[model samples]
Target: MVPVRDELFARLERFYDAIPRDGAHTEAFGGLVLFVRDGAGWPFYARPRLDATEPASAADVADVRRRQRELGLPEAFEWVHENNPELLAVARSAGLSVLEAPLMVLDPTALPSVTELSDVPVRLLDPAAPTFGADLAARRAVAAVGFAAPGTAVGGAGPAARDTALVELPLDALAEEQCRTESGHRISALAELPGQGAVASGMAMRVDDAAEIAGIATLPSARRRGLGAAITAALARRLLADGVDLVFLSAGSTEIARVYLRVGFRRVGTACIAEPA
Candidate 1:
């Protein structure tokens, strides 16, 4: 039988291509492809497909940078696999910073039994529910705190600075967007703490028949209590039950990756995010 990873990788590539651009233009230069949405709340980046050739030339890098500048978007590139050393070298030489994360996929046959942590009830939020407004506030608060915590991969700022920025976001709108099941995503959170609100939360985005689990976090005060794993497992189980063929996520670190591994997620490939130098 063929490797499951190859099939999943292909599905991922198709998923990226199918992302509704909402009128944004996409152009391909050799093996590199760029998506430009004019900063319309959609991702704008250059990416190399899994079957791309080696030795991404300096000219290719320059062309990508030129297009990004013309669109007035920051220069960013994403390499979905580790097979692009040549492209990565070209990107880095041109002053693009890189962050590498391990891509992980869940093995349904190996899934561990879901065990809810005591006193930490995990709740799936319904965007249409009467209490959605309050629940959304609590969910956003937990996310702000979790992402701002020291050593988080996404937030590079100090806690105070990150908190200030996160609080200013249009969270009401965000909550509305995330809670819409018709929008192909779902949000879940752990029970509220006495003063900290929701202590753990995560969301899943459906791409074709596969689901990408993202934004999983546990507040600092709730760390080490298995709340993170509990929420993750719960989300995975629900997605599988809903007929999602594949579920994957990019772990922020080996420590975080280990958490998913305990729940049957296997290492599949490397995921890279490149930003302007």
Candidate 2:
């Protein structure tokens, strides 16, 4: 098996590189937002930005700090466009605290069966179905309301719209083994990405067995019931059974991260955001 850290990093790199290249950027938000912006969202391998305040060889830590504050970029984030030790060191000096690292695991042998929850109901929705329209909106609305309490200005409404557009592509990429399950009408979870005939996270838009969690949500009224964990475990078991070899995902919150951990995931690395100095 590949080293856990290496696998996780490679998975993340694939995701960062896979963002649509036409007109936008996928900013993986956190203490350090990963800015994967390009026409093609190609993964950042190792290239230095000419906009840096100093040469990569003599990078001034203070320059990174100034640029971060000036641009309002996350205090801590990696400019994955290039790979340089000094770049990371400079960002660290600027108050960008480390958070949970990304993680990945290979399960070529398949995941164990997940016991069904007797109490909660699970629903599966077709990503291509027109009825799927309001589902994304509703989920984002609930997410917006949830994030508001934490003092963040996240507009789930927008992602909901973008999600509607991406669904067709990501769904098409999902393997037949990819399946979705939700807990009752209150919380829904889908393997969104397909991997190895099963749903895995991080594989979307281009290949199979590279599944992404596509979407997961709980009704505002149903928060705190642990429905999230139930849905995740159920999904994991189903995907594993389908022959998924590895799985990867990004967490929006520590709470979500903990739940995923309970389902057999471990942390690998974290990303950060930076801007031109």
Candidate 3:
């Protein structure tokens, strides 16, 4: 396992702070913190201060739960570091289920040389642009299909259900929220396949000095053709050019991790997402 650097972790902390949790509630107690973003449709866990001057206690866990109830969020929803077994135990004792994945980071010096695909055109979509609404809808459609494909993270959802949920998403509101804060910036892009509107799509968000690369998906018919890699590399390069140096993402699986590794990312630590059981 590549040791997680303190600076990288600090960046992660800031990135969390920079997220635009519009119309959300936040509470902090000792080593624990929680955010309830209604628009996000999920609650998020702030990095636990397990290593703070005072260790996390049962009181903190109780307080976090209390806040969750107040916000009407699910009984449990947290993003925690796997290294903190103490925190994980507390959440588990509270009846939360945990799913862990690798936290990967890209070091500028190790960026791989990814050749741009000439035949496939990849371009960034500006959220504020006039055509953003239609483009975003198309991108979300592609994402829903990608996520429902066999072997993907959100796989069990059949295409029809996935498409329905995605199509109903408030893309306009999401676009507005992504750009409302100075700390947040979202870049959406797509790879056009011959005769297909878009076969591959992804997005990256830069919050202050740190960035997260997410939603990289290629349609089933477009897999193994490097479209995913191309989109990821393009987004990363754009973020780097924009002056946000610390870039990271959570890989859903080892195969996906391998895809990211080709673009200079290395597994640094384990990231765990826990939700009500």
lDDT against the true structure, each candidate: 0.68, 0.40, 0.68
Q: TM-score, each model?
A: 0.78, 0.50, 0.79
TM-score of 3: 0.79
User: Which stretch of 10 consecutive residues in model 2 shows the poorest summed lDDT?
Assistant: 195-204
The candidate that wins on TM-score is 3
State how far residue 235 of model 2 sits from its true place (Å): 4.5
Clash totals, every prediction: 0, 26, 0
Error of 1 at 95 (Å): 2.0
For model 2, state the Cα shift of residue 128 in Å. Answer: 3.7
Ranking of candidates on TM-score, top first: 3, 1, 2
Candidate 2 ranges beyond 4 A from true positions = 1-8, 22-88, 92-118, 150-207, 214-220, 234-244, 252-256, 271-277
* Per-residue accuracy of model 2 over 144-215 as CA lDDT, tens digit each: 444444322233333333333333323422322123222111123332222211111111222234444433
Clashing pairs in 1: none
Candidate 1 weakest ten by summed lDDT: 156-165
Q: Give the TM-score of candidate 2.
A: 0.50
Model 3: lDDT equals 0.68
| TM-score (C-alpha, index-matched) for candidate 1 | 0.78
Cα lDDT tens digits for candidate 1, 227-249: 67777787888888888878888
